[model samples]
Target: MADEVKLYGVAGSPFVCRVKIALNLKEIKHEFVVEDLSNKSAHLIKYNPVHKQIPVLVHNGNPVSESLVIVEYIDDAWKGVPVLPQDAHEKARARFWAKFVDDKCIPAVFMAIGSHGQEQAVAEAHDQLQFLENELKDKKFFGGDSINLVDISAVFLAFWLGAAEEALGIKIVTKDKFPNLTKWSDNCINCQAVKDSLPPRDDLVSFFKMRFGKA
Candidate 1:
């Protein structure tokens, strides 16, 4: 019997993109169910009752919620190129950075994009970007030489960061300001596993414009 896999996600969501990247890396075949976030489907509610959020991975009948958790699940369930590191310390380090991307970088980026002309939010985002830049300065990738769970977790930096900047007419990551991060972003998005997973750039810009009421 073949394994059954289904993914419920919203269009252009960074979290959803994370799962998509992971599945693609693992070469896992699954059905993608795009959810109407404004009028979420009953299936999404049933599958993820607690958070009622998207990027739900339903495997063989069991549902997995939360993007990072679902990513770890994909790495575990499928035997392919490992997403998480094999060494114990390296795995822990990867998890820490992934969590940092989710907890720190994401919120900063959101605040910077959502709060127009807000000095504080923009500054916060800059600070976060600086931190990431410093971390990435001496490495090719967060996982060193290749993409990993940390890279997947930071997909927002790769795609949506640029999209948000373009849609809002605000520049966050730049060649001068965050040179390393800018290069890392390029490396990440250009990776074979991630290239096809991203939404079209123009579509994303339009989506952000409409989403932020700039359209």
Candidate 2:
């Protein structure tokens, strides 16, 4: 018998995109069950009772919640392309950067973009992007030649941030400010697997505008 894999997700969610990219990278066959976030399904609530969020991966009857967790799970469960590095130290470093993208970079980005480029928030966001700029200063991707856990984790910055910037009329990641990171973003979004997983740019831009009342 084959594994019964189902991903519960919303179309516009960057978190859901992360899991989708991971699945695509591994070439995992699964069902994408789109969830109306306003009226979440019983399976979503039952799988992730704590957060009741999308991007829940149900594999062979067991449930896994959280986008990053699901990505790691897919990488572990499937064996072909490695989303995480095999070396101990490199793997640890990759995990560290992915966590940073979530805990530090994401909040700073939201604060800056959500505040509509307020000086202080923009400064903090810049600092976060700069950190990534330094990290990606030499590599083609965060995982070196190919996408990895870190690249998957930072997909929001690669794709969704462009839509958010257009909708909010802000410029956080720019060629002048973050050349390396900007280049990396372009590469990530252009990667076949990542591109296949992203929502349409126009749709995402429209979503940000409406959701932020900028429409």
Over 4 Å off, model 1: 213-215
Candidate 2 regions with alpha-carbon error over 4 angstroms: 213-215
Provide TM-scores for the models.
Answer: 0.95, 0.97
Q: What C-alpha lDDT do the candidate models reach, one value each?
A: 0.89, 0.91
**Which one wins on lDDT?**
2
Candidate 2 lDDT, tens digit per residue, 1-215?
98899999987899999999989988989999999988999989999999998889999989999888888889899998999999999999999999999999999998887888788998999998888999998799999999999999999999888899998888888899898888899999999999999999999888878876443
| Per-residue lDDT value at 1 in model 1 | 86
lDDT per residue as tens, model 1, 1-215: 88999999976888999999999999999999999999999999999999999989999999999999999999999999899999999999899989998889889988888885378888898887787788887687888898999999999988987887888788766798887888888999999889878888998888778877453
